[model samples]
Target chain A: MRSLVQALGLALSDYRHEALFSACSVFVLAAVLAPLMVLLGVRNGVISAMTDRLLRDPRTLEIIPVGSGKYSPEWFRELAARPETAFVVPQTRSIAATISLTNPNRPNLGLNVTRIVATAPGDPLLERYGLPEAGFVRDEKSADPLYPAPLVIVSASVARKLAVPASPQELKDPAGYWLEGRVERVLQGRREAAGINLRVAAVLPPEALGVDAVFVPLEALAAAEDYRDGKNAPLFRALAAPRAEKRSEKAVTPENFEDYSASLYREREYASFRLYARSLDAVEPLWKWLAAREVEVYVKVEEIEAVKSLDHAFSVIFGLITGAALFGFAASTAGNALAGVRRKSRSLGLMRLLGFPGAGIVLFPVVQSLLTAFSGAMLADLLYLIVAFAIDSLFSASLPGKAAVCSLSPGQTLAVFAAVLAVSALSSVAAARQAADIEPSEVLRDV
Target chain B: MAAPAPIVLALRGLRKDRRTERAEHYSLSVPALDVRLGEKILISGPSGAGKSTFLDMAAMALKPDAADEFFFFPGARAGDGRACDIAAAWTRKDIERLAMWRKHIGYVLQTGGLLPFLSAEDNIRVPSKLLGLSAQKDKTARMAARLKISGLLKKFPAQLSVGERQRVAIARALAADPPLVLADEPLASLDPENARTVLDMFMDNIEDAGTTLIVVSHATDLMENMDFRRLILETGARDGKAFAVLKEGPG
Candidate 1:
């Protein structure tokens, strides 16, 4: 015990005795560790921010179309039957028609066409999109043009462009210059759009909308197109066929939807479908199952890197910057430490005479490196948090509600700290080799 | 009590050389030599007579360039009956034997070889520590008392005068209480009085321990007080041949 303590004390005292060597080691450690620590923080910040944003809108993980076409209704129904499957629904996307809402006194100005998407009532996508429930009654006396069986939610930009009145009485009164109508909710999509009220039912985050975009119930839209509501429009019914076993001879394809919709009077086979699973892991196997049925279906999965191009770019930039910083650190630190070790060769000679092993001399620089790196990492991580929070608060970016709450997990911190220490320790290997090369004979000679 | 067995150390026809003009060239040889236990032998010669070189060979720190046999009793022999022929051990496991041999046979260099970082006392304790001495305080105090370096214990080698540093070196040489001591012009840098003072201290401590001492010196006065055996080196016609003329000291 005494020997062990003595060895440690001697090692510690030896570090102090060689001031230049210790300083060089510590400087190198700090150099390598500071940028490495900063890189760790940057990775943590970007990953955490993306995760928070995606998680806040649960529908970010939905399998939306990358190209044309969608999954078969029968395939979707089969997937929905599985215990792991969470939710399954159909969606149709199209451009909203440019319709004129004229003002009698002023010259007409052209408005941008709105984007229209069809969805079901009480769908999981509504909450994921931050949309209020359907049937959010705006006014009782309103004879709104956009509502009846086919309800629509319009972008706030559209409402302002068409000069829609704020209330039912305002629209009805002579000053309103329009008939009373029920407003569903405001669409708060991020992209550009013109005002044309489809009756805003729920206001979404700005990222959700585009142009003069609107969301309408699938059934009502189908009914209106079929002219069922005393207007000339088409009607279509979404349906699913019985699940086909693997042994069956009827090969499923795009022609099937057309044939089935035409033949079946009561049920119209849907052209597209979306299959949901309990988690991301189940997606691959289910996709294979559909493929086995000879159904020409393509699948897509959601990862944070998918929609967040900015985050991926941030990661690459961070890595390059961190690497360059560490290189400068290793150069300056290792050079200084080696010089220090060479200067103290005589003192080291005395220690050798005092019964210290050749390996013990290396310990002096190694300990100093470890201490500096740990402290530097903690400092960098603290600075990262302060910067991330300050930016989020200042910009008021609908950046994601949880951006302020972003944080690195314990596993992440441990890995980064260990990596920095390993690099710093490696820088001392040259100094250790120099210390080991001392010849006691040289010390005894008259220098 | 039975007579204590005599430990004998000898050198015979020892030849050593250096490479001259990139060709191996033989330089000198001592034909025969012998010393019994507890006998002081002073080697005297003109400049370039290889006195220090010979001392190094005797101390086991250097190997002879050429030799028929070099032998030490109380040591194991090789198949050729030569102690020098035995393979040297340098590994950590054999370091104890190496250190023990080194501690017992001390070398006082011409220049003060005291470790610069250590004070006078720590330098004295070097061999003691190497020999695994735990009661360092007692050993240091005892050596300081004998060598009269008690007041200079805390002073570094640089701080001490030339004579004082040599005294510290002698104390270090005697630290392990070795059976033999070797000094190469130990008083070379000191004034006459300081040199004699150092010589007197060395003689008293070594006589009390009954340890054999070998001193290589230029001055005859340092050798007068003690009864010593002398080996004088005289060059011959051939480069490899040298005669060692032996003479008895005043008894």
Candidate 2:
């Protein structure tokens, strides 16, 4: 190790001997590189910001089945276990997924039919809608004893439908209105079903849920489907009424009677599911994965394309600048190093005459060239950081807490370093050749 | 009787051809010669007689055109007493091994060949640094002191007088304790008085180090009293090519 250091010390001394020349070269390279660094940093930051914004959009990662398809219970479990699946909730067929909601306190409001969607914790839309983290339960069947009624979160439209023509008490806080869900079966032109009283835990704003719907937990949606399909819902006593009463007595029978039906209905297989990818980048892979598994899905292909095109545009701009800078640097460095060879021929010949091998003589110029380039690149990166920080600070006043407008990722930073190394090495080729070809005896003849 | 020293260098039937402006080309031939350890030899020749070419061949800088035997046994590298076949290394184009062998030889240029960028001290330390001679860490100081150029150690070669430059070059040659030192007209650019001073100091240092010295010079009258084996190159021209053959001469 010491011997290698001793050998390298000579080259270092050569660099130190002409410190002014070296410093000048370093300054030239730094001046050339600083603007390029800024350009790349800005490109990286803007593209990253665009990608992140698209990724944050809930629909960007949504995967909906093309048509109704039966998904077995095991399919959902496996899909949930996949690394790409962020959240999934199996949905019942749309025909049986509707329920009429009413505000019990306001008898004047009529029944308003609303679609009920399957929801669970970590639903992106709900998460972005700022769902209160604590009160929401993923399964209504497993709800704590304190909250017995089935809980549902209503959309702004649904809330307005149930709260409008507001009673005196509801006019103050309409979003927290109590709701009752009624499932009815008309037989012989008479409505003969009971109402299942439900509570509206929270109402999402219009930005999150544009349509009038009730966000029912997955288990609750399944139970509702079961009750409507002639299956016994043991917990949903209002919908579990016996359907076998004689025709004459049916009219007099009371609603909400829990005489369990003996027959069972086919259940648990869902028509489709609402699935989200773990990330924006995972969307395509997950889509492809589902397609490969014969599960046809509909994704936001055009939206994803728009996001990718942003990266493509940045790449084009970066490529142009990189090509021009690469050529400029290569030409400048080759010219500089080759000129030094001519200027220092006598010195090089002396080294050759002093018993240094051809390789050492070659390294004499290359080492100095690399030193200048390396130092110059370091300075440029430092300058870029200062400039980026200044630019980002300006953004802090306007778009506070958002991503910076000028920054480079670690990979981008490494690319800059690698570019400098490759260019420096390529530029010193002519100088190294000239230095190696110098004959030791040339010193004698030239003297 | 004292034990005889090992041969430091040996050559036989060696020849080199160089293109020259003075003629279409010039050829140098040395039939046979053996240099022992700690011995000194001098070659005096007329201008254009290829004296520098001989020095070049000895320094391993110029590959000879033809040779029967070309060898160097420097007695360097601590205790590894191996004879280096110069001809084989040249034929194999093994530049690394050639450089290793060159570490044992120090060449002094006609104009002191010190790098203009390095200080006088750095110039003298070049050989030791290149050869990684840690044992001779203070050789630059001792050599500068002996040459009386300690005051100029911090000055670059361009800042030194012609005499001071030559002194620095000599110190550089001896810095690594090379077994062989080849001086090519070390006093060529010096005046008579400065030449005498540099040459005397150079010789005293070589003798003190007990190293072999091979000097090529044209100043025959200046070295009239110096004792050494003498050789001369007889220069001639035929068919636009001047040829020189090595021959013995009285010292």
Candidate 3:
């Protein structure tokens, strides 16, 4: 161990003594290494940005079932229970799950039909837009409560149609807007419509959906479908039960109405539901799972795959370039090290004569190569930093606040430096062999 | 200390074959030789007479073509000494084992083989450091002072004069307190005054340590008056092969 340290110190001294020659070698190494570093940084930067763009849009993780299909409650429960499933909720047929809205206080605003999308507590779309989730909540804000059922959250498109020239009080808090929600259908070739008072809870941005739409609790969509299909709605039927007998019409009050609405029409299967996967990696498995059951979904798999393939292509290209560079550099360094041993044969022979072991002599070149390559790596790191800073400064506007377009993470930088040293040591294999072949007698007889 | 061994090195029937630059076969042989502890010997020969070859053999850097017996005992006392079979190590190509014995022997090259990268003091300390001698620090300083090279200790080999480099090489050899020291033309590259000065100081230091010495040189007149065991290589050509044999030379 002491001999090894001595060898290392001797190597350092030798390298310093021949500073100009060593500098030339280090420059050549850094010249090759710096470009490869820049390439790797760019690869990481571009791939990270592409991946972040994909991840930022939650729709990329969504897996929507196509059209209408019989989705069992157990199936939905399983889907929701899946490790890949981020969120899942049962839905109804599109035709039956809709409503027409109008402000009852203003005659100017007319009723308009809007599709009702089934949403639950973990609806990604509503949450992404900073809107309230569709679920039951206490109405402490209202003096005279309208209903205790799920509140209606509308998109900006529908909210605009239902909005009247608001009074000052209405403008201050528009979530209290009362809209008369009516569901219409034709049963037995006759048109029948049922009206219900709906309160606006939150208005989602149009980015959620362009056309008029309403996000309601999954139960609300189920009840709407049942009422339109001529099935019994617990809330609507309870209200109409006393009317046919001319009994007291005020039997259903706001506090007791929740008990009536909670008893929704129960079904084993649903027509549609909102679903999402936990991550991009989860989407393929979830998509494959549904496809195995003959359920086709309208997921953003192709876009996700596009980004992933781009990442793969960049990685392959980077690997090829970096591999070629490292191999070439190692080869060149080996050749140079062999030549260096030959040039310094006399000095090396002197050390051998001084009782320095053959192994110590071998390590002499290895330690020198490490010193040279480590210096080169430092220069490469400096060059990479400058290039990355220049790239980020030049292209900052390309990704906005998303990410830097040309930079390496700290871990990657360290890996690159370590690889440089390892390869440098490996390059000295030939030199070590040459050093071992040197005899102490070379100095005596050469003269 | 135990009683000193009478014989420090023994060799018999040592021979080597070589090819000259003109493609002529040449041979050098040593019949039988033994040196006692504290003995100083001079090997004088003409140019191309195999004096360096003899030193190379003693240094264990050149493998002998054939050897009936070749052994070196570093420690003169029985308790601390063991016979080192240099011939057997050479036959087996056991370089590590041979390198281990180099600790007790020092070889001074003809051209002052000093590492150009190291300072004069570091060059002198290398042998002692290689042996892991605990007294290396003080020994190097004392060797440098005795050689009158204390002022030149901080200078690298390239920065010093030829005479100074030779002195440093001599100090490097003696600093480790080896039992035997071999020098090949230690004064060949110097003027008369520097040669006399270096040779005298080298002899004085080795004598103080009671180390056996073997000096190979082509200059016999310079050591005409010096009292030492003298051997010389005699060269002759026969049957298209030139041959040299080592034996006692006229004092």
Candidate 4:
């Protein structure tokens, strides 16, 4: 250890006058590495921000089955049995449906042609969109079996169109203004059922999908369209029955009707479904399972994975470029060391004559290289800080998350430091070899 | 009579060849030679007589062609009566052995080959530092005072005159108090008065330190007033072998 210290001291003493050269080497290394560090930092920050944004919104975890396909009651029951299933709700086929909303007190202001989105009770999306639990349970069951009152959650835009006052004073007077809802099938041009009234239980923020639509109970919408569980297939079948079969159905009393109803209705079918997993981990597996069954599945997992893959590819490309730059730095350092050895040949010979071993002399160049590399790495870190600050100030407002746009983590900084030291150590090999091979006799003769 | 002063250095059948592109010049062959403890020997030869080559071979700084034996005992008392075979030392090519040999022997070049970066005092202390010896400030100061270079100890080699540089070099060679000192044309780059003074001080210091000396030079007149052994090398007419002949006994 003492020998090593002496060698270091000697190297420093010899290089004291050549400070400018050392500084130049350090500057060149810093210039090469600072930009790469900034690039890596930006990639990490942007990707992490986007990923966090998706994870923050639980709706990204929803798995929807796409295309025209009936979800039978048995299929929903089976899906609900899975341990990872959170809430499985059946959705109505409301593709061409629209709703009209109006305040009874101010009929002049109305919401016309607003889209209708129907969801079942106990749906997890209600909580995700910040709806109160009471809103979901409101009007859960009605006394009359034939007709049920619909509970609606209107978006901010729909509420605004209806001229509903958002203040607490107006909210306390429920009788002051009543909102009415009427569902219409515009594409089919049909008006076969009575229009049902609805009361807005809550209003959603602009960020939610329901902001531009009116959310209502799926059963209520089905009743309004006279849409049965199986689209009234049994009624159509009964009406087309022969006269003898129809007379037999009329002979049964209402009290005894339950006995014959077992064979009355077929299984229900849905056009599509919205599946909510219990956690984020179940989304990918459930999507894959449904996709394998020839059902088109849509989720945010694919988009998140695409962004991550792009970030990884960017990192690899930046790493390759940085590696090339480091190689060039090493070559330049080795060249300088070789030249130094030639210039200081006489001093090295004198040390040899003084009984210093070749091993000791070799440490001279290695120590110098280490010092230079460490200094350059420190300089690069300072430069990185400045660059990161400038970038964050310029682009933070445009970024999504609260964090800065370009910031390096501590782990990344340490990795950069270790890499630079390794390259510098490798560069000193040739110079050390030359220093060891010097002959004191030849040098002394020349003197 | 007094046990003949144990042999400090002995060699038998030492030979070295100097080859050049134009011609084969200056090949040396020494049949046998021995130097007693505290003996001063002067080697006088012409320009191409291989005087410096012999000193280099003895110091283990250069390789010899072939030799039956070459040995260097540490001191006159000869610890364990063991001798180091110079030829064997060269064959191993071990850096540790070279360092050990250099620590026990001191070589003074013609122009005081001191590192230009280090001060005069640091140049003198280089041997001790490399060998990891204890503090030698007292010894350094005494040597500097004896060589009349006390004031120049803090100055670099380039800052000192030629004579002063030579004095510092001699001080450095003797700093470790080695058993043998080799001087190759130490007076070559000095005026007459400065050369005489430096030579007197060198001889006095060596005698006081009880160190053996081998001085190589072409000027025979420098040794006219001193009683010393004279080794002469001359090129033979037929075999082209330069043989070193001892002309006087040890003084």
Candidate 5:
């Protein structure tokens, strides 16, 4: 180790005398490679961030029952009990329900179209969509198993359409331009129903949901449409009770609506329900399990696969470019090393004449090559960091949510460093051989 | 009677072939030669008489044509030291042994083979450094002072005059205190005054260190007053063999 260090010191001293030339060589390499490094870093960072963002949305892992089938409440309970099932919320038949928004201060703004999505309070999509907590209080006297609040979360575009004030001061005032939400439903394709008013509980960022979608509690939509629980066979049959000749004049409230609407429907069926998997890995297994049961399933697995393929394609492209760059770097370094050997032939011969072992002297050129390559890699890394920071700073706001424009992971940095060192070391073989082959007789003959 | 000095280096029936594009030629043939411990011998020959080749063979830098029975015993303790056959050393592929052998036998080239990048002192210390010997600075300084090159130690090879460079080279040759020192025309580049001074210093230092010395030169006039043995080689072909003779005294 000490001898090796001494040889390295000698190499360094040799380089010190030719510092400018060495620096130029390093700079040439850095110039060729820095841009490539930045390109790969950006490619990896953007693609990974996009894939991660999509995967993080639990909705992407949803497997919906596509075709019509009878799914009992017991079946749903069993499915939900599985460790891989995060949540299994049944979809209501009122898929055509649209909501409109109005701000009292801007009455001139017309009703804007919005799609209504039904969700339970504990639905994972709520957290995935970054919605605030629903403030529903259960009444002790209420007999209903589920009583949903009238609150709704609107997309950012919807809030803008209603001209709702986004400032904290204005938002604190209950009367200051309260955004009015109204849900419109058609009953059995006959009469147009009056709109049910709802309060705007929160506004989601544009990235949270689709452009014009609004989220509401599932029970609220079911009650407004007088929809029965089709998954529950017993409940569906019990709801088919004969109607009395004289109907009760009292208005049906959310508190006791289940008893009043018992004789509405008989069929134990459902259009579909969202099936959430515990994780991305479980999504495929759960989909396969559900498909094996003869249930038609739809998932974002294709999209996930596409993202994976794109990532792989990018990696191959990056590998090709990096391979080419490394090849060029190796060739250039080898040429430089050969030239250096030719120039220092005398010195090498003198060392040999002094009884220095050829094996130890061979490390001279290799050490110099490694030092040059290491300096170049460090310079390129510095340049990459600067470029990444500049890009992130320049375009951070335009990026999706908090994603950076460019970044390099620790693993990627290490891989690049290793690759550069390996290339540099391998390239110096010819020069080392030349140095070792130098005979003390050559110096004698030359003198 | 005092005990006879043990033979430090001996060779018999040694031959070396020089090859070129056209044909092979015999470079050197020595019937017999021996140098005892602490002995100084001077070799004089015309050009192409294999003077340098003989020195190269002694330094183990060249391979001999014959493959058997050439001996070099390094240390003074004849009982403890073993004679290394030069033919076997030539055929062995282990470079470490060659390096070790070279470390024990110093060579001073015709023109000083000092690295241009190193100072005179550094050039002198190269062998010591190569051998990983510690505390060689004092020895190097003493050699430089003995060679009258102490003032030029800090200068690079290019900065020193021819005489100074030769003196530094001689200092470097003895830096490691090898048992055998070989010089090919050590005083050829110096003036008469510097040559005489360097010669006296070289004899004194080698005598003090008890080193066996072999000096090869073409200057016969320089060997007239010296008490060292003279080995003269006449270049000629004899009975299908090109050979040289080793005369015991000034011829």
Candidate 6:
């Protein structure tokens, strides 16, 4: 220990004169690792953020057809009866005729595609998708009086695009425009799902429901589509009833009555069945089972896995790049350390003649190199932090916010530091060979 | 007085070679000789009489071109295959024999081979440091003072006048207080006054310490008044013959 300290002292006392070389070594080491550290941190932060959003939302379990399919509603209900089932809901897509107030004299000409997601009353999945309450929208009389309009939930962007230009107060009047609809809700938190307006609801976070899809009742959507043909498909009538009623109380039923009589109906119109599951873990199995039961289904389990794997891949890639950078830094530091020792051969000879052992002589350069490397690492870390913050401020993106929290685990940092120090120290050892063989006879020679 | 115990440093059957007086000749037939401690020995002869060769052999710094022969010097113990530690003569295990040997032995020549980088004091301290001598600082300061080089301790060899450099070399040779000091030609690079002063310092200190001194010089007149045993080498027909003279007292 004493010998090691003595060697370190010598190196420190003498190496100060070579400021440029020492500084260059430090900069080289830091340059190699700083970029890797920042990139890894940023990648980790973004991936974690995405994963957190995905995990916070409830996973979709099963999807049932309310418009066209080979299976009757009874089949869907029967499949939903499995012990592994979570929630079974009917869904469909349709286009609704949109009228422009400025051009109302011509006719309601604009048509927009919409997703009609039908849920049973108090369905847990309704909250999962950030949907409005079942009775949030009520029937309202129109100015024309001839055509009664169904309640509609429009995306905020769609609302703006469809509504005629008006002052803020006038825009809020609800009846100022011919397409006047109640401002039931405003979606927040996610940009992708913004600009959506629910009749009596606030907008859902964009990440929760995705793009601005218009929401309408299943029966309403089915009725709207009935104009395409003389009669609506039996699958629609079977799955779009707003309420469930007993067969004994029904005056009439669809042609597939015998095939789906036992199926429950909801709101005396569209029917809904609650799929009870023993546990959340079994939801996927239930989905697959229903899918095999001649029912069209959508599985959310795969979606969650997809999001998880994507985040994992991001982290892995960052790690690989960081590892490569650290390796390169280690190599550079090692080379510099070795060269520094080689350059001091004569100085080392003097020490040996002064009675220092081989190991003692080697210790000076090793300790010196390690000290330089550590100081470089600290400087690099500080500079990287500043850069991260600067980037965040320059762009109004989420990058800056996430960068502030970018950090590596203590174990990882220590491992990297240890590796760098070891490599540098070893390089110095390699250069100490010349010092190991000094002959005492040199001091007695004439010159 | 009873015969003093012989302080023998013998070179048994030592031989040399020459072919028509050529430098690279490898033939051998020279006679062996012995040296005693406390004796100031000189090998005076013509240029080709092998005076330097004999000195090199006696100092153990060089080997003969060809020969397998027995050898003995002042400090070689029985069964010992190596030279003695002249520097740290008192410390055996503490100071390695080879290191002490190198440190203690001092050699000077006509060209003044004092290290160019060091001052006179540092050059003298070099052997002490190598021998692990703890009293080097005191010894170096004292030697520099004794040689009147106290003020010149920081001056480099190149900065010193020729005579001053020779004196510094002499001071360095004596700084470690070694048992054996060898001078190929101590006065070769100095003026008469400086050579006399330096020779006086060497003789005065050598007598005080009873240390062995061997000098190879061509100036027989300068050596006339010195109290040293002279060995004159005869050339050609009698190349190996060495005649010894003891100036001490009826020896």
Computed on C-alphas against the true complex, the DockQ of each candidate is 0.12, 0.46, 0.63, 0.39, 0.41, 0.06
TM-score of 4: 0.68
Can you give the lDDT of residue A367 in candidate 2?
76
Off by over 4 Å in 4: A1-5, A17-63, A67-296, A299-320, A391-406, B75-80, B236-251
How close to the true structure is residue A296 of candidate 6, measured as C-alpha lDDT?
54
Number of the predicted model whose lDDT against the real structure is largest: 3
Q: Candidate 2, A190: how far from true, in Å?
A: 7.6
Q: Whose DockQ is greatest here?
A: 3
True contacts kept of 6: 0.02
Error of 5 at B61 (Å): 2.3
Residue A372 lDDT in candidate 5: 80
Model 5, C-alpha of B239: deviation from truth (Å): 9.2
What tens-digit string does per-residue lDDT give for candidate 1 at B1-251? 97643544666677666443423453656777766667778877765666766766666544566665666543311112223221133322343233235544666777666766567886787666655667778867876787888999998888998888999988887776665678888888889988888888988877776667788887767777677877676544345544333234334
lDDT of 4 by residue, B1-251 (tens): 45677788998888887764434554688788898778889988776567888887777777788888889886554544577777887777665577567777878888957877678998888776655777799999988999999999889888999999999999988888877888889998999889989999998899888888999987658777786788877656446533443334334
Could you list the chain B TM-scores for each candidate?
0.80, 0.93, 0.94, 0.91, 0.89, 0.76
User: TM-score for chain A of every candidate model?
Assistant: 0.50, 0.69, 0.69, 0.54, 0.62, 0.46
Would candidate 6 be rated incorrect, acceptable, medium or high by CAPRI criteria?
A: incorrect
Span of ten consecutive residues with least summed lDDT in model 1 chain A: A178-187
The residue-by-residue lDDT of candidate 1 on A1-447, one tens digit each, is 333334345555555545575565555455555555545554556555664455433454344433334445555567677765565554432312223233333335334344444555445556555555543223222344232332345555555565544343443343324212121211232222122223345534445544564555554333322322122222221112212222333332334533423332234344344444444445556556656755455444445346455555666776688678767665655654566556666655544433445555566455655555566556655665565566446643655444433345679768767766675567665776666455344443435
Candidate 3 residue-wise lDDT, B1-251, digit = tens: 98654777899999989987743898999999998788889998778878888888888878889999999988763335578999999889887677778767878887758888989998888877777777677777787888999999999998999999999989988888787899999999999998988888998898788888999987667877887899988988899899999999875
lDDT of 4: 0.69
User: Per-residue alpha-carbon lDDT of model 5 for B33-83, expressed as tens digits?
Assistant: 888888888898877677888888788776677734688886654454677
Candidates ranked, most accurate by DockQ first: 3, 2, 5, 4, 1, 6
lDDT of each: 0.54, 0.75, 0.77, 0.69, 0.69, 0.53
Candidate 4 per-residue lDDT, tens place, A1-447, comes to 455566567778666646787788778778777776776677568755655445545576678766657767777777788777787765656563465677776879787677666665566766765474322222322233233345567777877878766543555455433466554332234333224456566766656654567776554443433322223311111212222221222343335434323322234466666688766667777777677767787778775466456656766876787678666766766665676677777777766766666777777777777787788889988999998998889989987546789877899899888877877776675677776765577666764
